[model samples]
Target: MTDTTAGTPAATDGGDPPDGSDFGVGEEGSDDPRIEFRGGKWASTLPLVFFIAWAIFQSGVLGIGDTNGLVVGALVGTTLGMFLVRGDWKAYADTIFEGMTQRVAATAIVAWLWAGMFAQTLQAGGFVEGLIFAADALNVGASTFPAAAFILCGLLATGIGTGYGATVAFVTLVFPAGVLIGANPVLLFAAILSGAVFGDNLAPVSDTTIVSAVTQDADIGGVVASRFKYAIAAAVPAFAAYLIAGSAMAGVSLEGAVALRESANALGLVHLLSMGVVIVTAVVGRHIVEAISWGLVVAVASNLLFGLSSASDIVAFTVTEAGALSGLPVVEVGETAGVGGSLYTGAVGFFPLIVLTLLIVAMAQIMIRGGGFEAIQTFLLDRVATTVRRAELTMVLGTATINGMITINTAAEIAIAPYVARIGEKFNINGYRRANILDANTSALGYIFPWAGGVLVGYQVMVGPDGLGSQYGPEMVVNPIEVVPYVFHGWFLVAIFIIAAITGFGREYIPDRASEEVSRA
Candidate 1:
């Protein structure tokens, strides 16, 4: 009922999600030049180093807050990186192109494209509005609001598959309501982010999940199921924390919330059926792209049949003056046209991100070739990661270290995934353990950090024109910094993974045991 659901397709089918846990590579003895890095390890590392430095400066220092801006910076930086390629620029260029086109990056990109379309159509169908109605009917007060909000947002994030979307929705819609009913602003923001952490970590359709599974050479179904226990464990304490915080911080405010109940349509709740199809398909071991595409079809059909939106709105690819048209050929000499509606806008929203993912993968490939990955591997294996326990801890610490530097988690996941695969394999660590380490930090840090993609998106909604600040005033806006201390779920998830590594809670090894998989197709 928190009214968020302009979302990612959160998870695939869960045979029920628990405790968690590649890069693809070829034979070690092979001398294939294609697998080789042309430059020395130090030289190969320059591009990755450059990108990290640019990231630290851009998001951490300059505070530009533009995702696309980071992409541009990556482009320029990587091109400069090519200068360090010792031999022919042709081979270097080819390596970059090959990395850009590889199947791992392609799989996640395709899934995202379908997810965007499905999420948009679902939003058009009033899924979130129904949630708002649910909230109003419950009539939650300050003491119960934060906890309730966390649960609702968690469900919505699971259904939608996007923590960022959930954060924006909750921050925009539920935050004001919580504030009006007297929940602390910091606690409210943390509740929103914690819900995001739950969804992003558990959602099968999530990019982080897809990236973790594909990069580590494991199936998505196995990844989600194996990771369930850790998610629930962290969530239990997080839920209790929200409960206590909600009560302790309770106060009275005279200003009432803007009513969202009037806007919800009962028919919109039927989209839950569409969400079911996605989950069942995913849980049954279907391909993520196929699973989400079917969900998108259901969303479109539901929108029209339920009268949530019109056919024109579904494909309103109209040429108009207000929006600019660059790529489409529909423009005349003086006429400019643009697209609207569910399908186009939905899919298009992810284009930049998909490209950025590809470029980062390309950079990662360069690092692997140049022995940069091996160099880091040697350092960890020799000095820090001397034992299984130490190796696991190193994995956790290493993942956390990279995530802390990078702003967008999905990109950071891609960047660090190869190292996780290589290092974990050295200890014969299970794919699930490696992945859990890779993903837990990747998902957790993004929500906790002030400049993180998830947090920034939520904050943007809060301060935007129609946001809480505009509706109420500046006092209602939750600063990114203020909310960090209260981000209980993110912090707990990280701690759980670290403790899991040290204590051997949910660790497993491949070949010794196969992961739990979907039994039916």
Candidate 2:
């Protein structure tokens, strides 16, 4: 009988695995006690290799920058994983199931529930209008508009902790105005993405931030503080590019520019305190969902009692006629009340997000079961990563590669987290530094890859046939294929890390000898 756990030879120390065994891990046991090649290392790395190659082909060679290519990558990686594992297919299946159910599946469900509640609450509370007010209040020459827009969008995304949401908002509100005024669409889109990249990396409430801290066993504050440098380094250059691009794009000023200015000024103070509630609560280390829930309540109350919106109109916002509550009609608004409610908006916005989360989790499960994850991990640790610095680079490259295949940034982080933490611990790398590295790269690459959900969604909004592209033609927003060539920020961030790895710059606490000798909790 073959020993199923043969690939990775980890002695369960003095005790058996927590569930008594590895989820009924194959009954076959080998007593050889020799450093026998059970095939775990090479087995784990197989998925890594397949994903890297596939990502390059899909994004670089074939130039098919879509989710379709990602699905194909997942398939190829899974098949390769299964071919490497030396166990009964059933055992491999069980392991993968356990991994998915515990990590990705559980996290996604919670994230979506809170995501739905938060997104809906924000829309119902008129957050977007408030932003529009801000945009309208500012009337600058075309030259400085891009930089201002980029900074403002960055702030918005940082506050919301959702880059995709920020992208859609910026594209819809700022992009059109920029175009009408003769701003460079390609630079505008790049600026939007750059802002998003900043928030995704720095936001305390960001998914990548949460995963990196949790996986590396570091406090969120520490991780954020450590990563601040890298984010700034990448962002400054990107921001400057947008500013220069904005200046270069020529535009013909229009008549209603003054009218647009007035609308922005009118709603400038429309319950902005509601937004403050979210940012403050989040910074205080409260759970994001709970914070957003509080924000929602404050927004609704302020809208009604403060007369931000008519009471009847507020009611209309809760239940549209087309909804289940719609059939049981309630009061009318200023005229005929339209359907409205946080529930309505939240469900609409988060439905696709929930589906994406689940599908990605399932794909991850398939890769793990196929033995792809193990294949790659083993190969890197033993062969290429012969030193501490090499291991860190492996971590950086590994995070980037998985994200390209998975599309969901947080999912990719979770998938490779164990390996990252394990490798770091072996090399005495600081927890804070490790967490910072994980999040920085995850945020940077997830959007740059064409297959990434953020990129696809953003691309659709900016350049879809009937999208902003139709109204302005190619002049407004460049195609996804074209955007890749000019994604300087993405390339710059990657280069920064490569330099760090080679120079040992920004080294932090490397758990000392005394700390290293202590047992891992």
Candidate 3:
């Protein structure tokens, strides 16, 4: 879940000066060599503009939430932008390669792959059955399921430090359990995403958290500490909203709900220890990849040892002719040939998202190298952000706008980071305050939008061939668009920051205090 890429430079300075001297100033509008475009710097926005339009049309107007379709949109947008480049076409081509190879994109890709495999492994070990058993034993009716799910999912996400991982795990496991117990599917999905938003905003190890702190020259620990107030401010209301909505909303009456409860096995709850292993490892500062690997191993071993699943169930090779591998537990003869398993299916589910992320980053790079960001920064500083309040508001709104366009929140945070730093330093804002403003909007908007990475990852789990919809019924599949309005935590977080920006609720000037040296937590 913590996707901080290797080789990210830590901030060396302690904090920006309160005098608003030369420190962190002119970083945004300074003259620098950039790729020229046919219609001035404004033309650099063509790729991102086209991609955003396609995303809105595909996800909003047409109601198709397919990540692959968005991939096509990005592909077409990037291809079209090449025609507008003024200089050598090779420079544009190289920029595409550069964007695709960025550490931010790679970090997200690696986290998704590892998180996917770990989540599927847990499902294979009967984690969903375990939750169903717990729900039934505790007499948790549909009226309170969303609230309970929100808390549990939030805890897991906070511990693991990856909202994407939490979304994948909860949607794959806890979502079906909530549905079987008669919770409204859309509400439950929204609650899960809300929990992810909470963790992504507050988790010290989160990539967005790292980026926000590093860009603002604040310590990661202090950033996490300072943002706790904002996170809780949003979470309290979100939890209450879920409770109220859970009661008002009705759940689908499934034919076998009673039978599923009756047949639930408590032994499956043993996987809780497997989940605990990952959480503990991650919280202890081990790499997320290592933590998930340990958890996957424990899950697979538990499934085999406890008779929860078979080796073939966890992984299997299907061959038209088994040949020499016929005797192996994972090999079998079938009408078709392919590799199938928790690991394979889990990793394969995110293939489209991986490609989309790369393409989107490429588009963002096009905007960056073509001086599109500089143009926006100049406009905001020169025309709009004249006061401290307006500067803070611009940072909040600007971060939200960019995150809305870029599905990857971390990448969006990276794109808008310099502008945020420049704007905050112009007013001598404290680094922690600036980081909070930067990360809160980045974390919230990423999960709320239909085309967002967090929402799409969870949706992929629901709609896959062997997904929850296939296992249960079509009602189990919550459309990405349907859950948008219900992500109370995301909306609440953004609202809290906007109000804070206007009212100076948590604003701190650099004269109030200087932050400690920045370091990776």
lDDT of 3: 0.86
Clashing pairs in 3: none
The best candidate in terms of TM-score: 3
Candidate 1 lDDT (Cα, 0 to 1): 0.70
Model 1 regions lying over 4 Å from their true place: 1-40, 141-146, 152-193, 203-226, 246-268, 317-336, 406-432, 450-486, 507-521
Scored by lDDT, the top model is 3
Candidate 2 C-alpha lDDT tens digits along 247-304: 7755544455455444443342444676567657766766666666676677667766
Worst 10 residues of 3 by lDDT: 19-28
Candidate 2: misplaced stretches above 4 Å?
1-133, 141-143, 168-182, 249-265, 268-271, 298-346, 457-478, 485-489, 512-521
TM-score list, all predictions? 0.74, 0.70, 0.93
Order by TM-score, highest first: 3, 1, 2
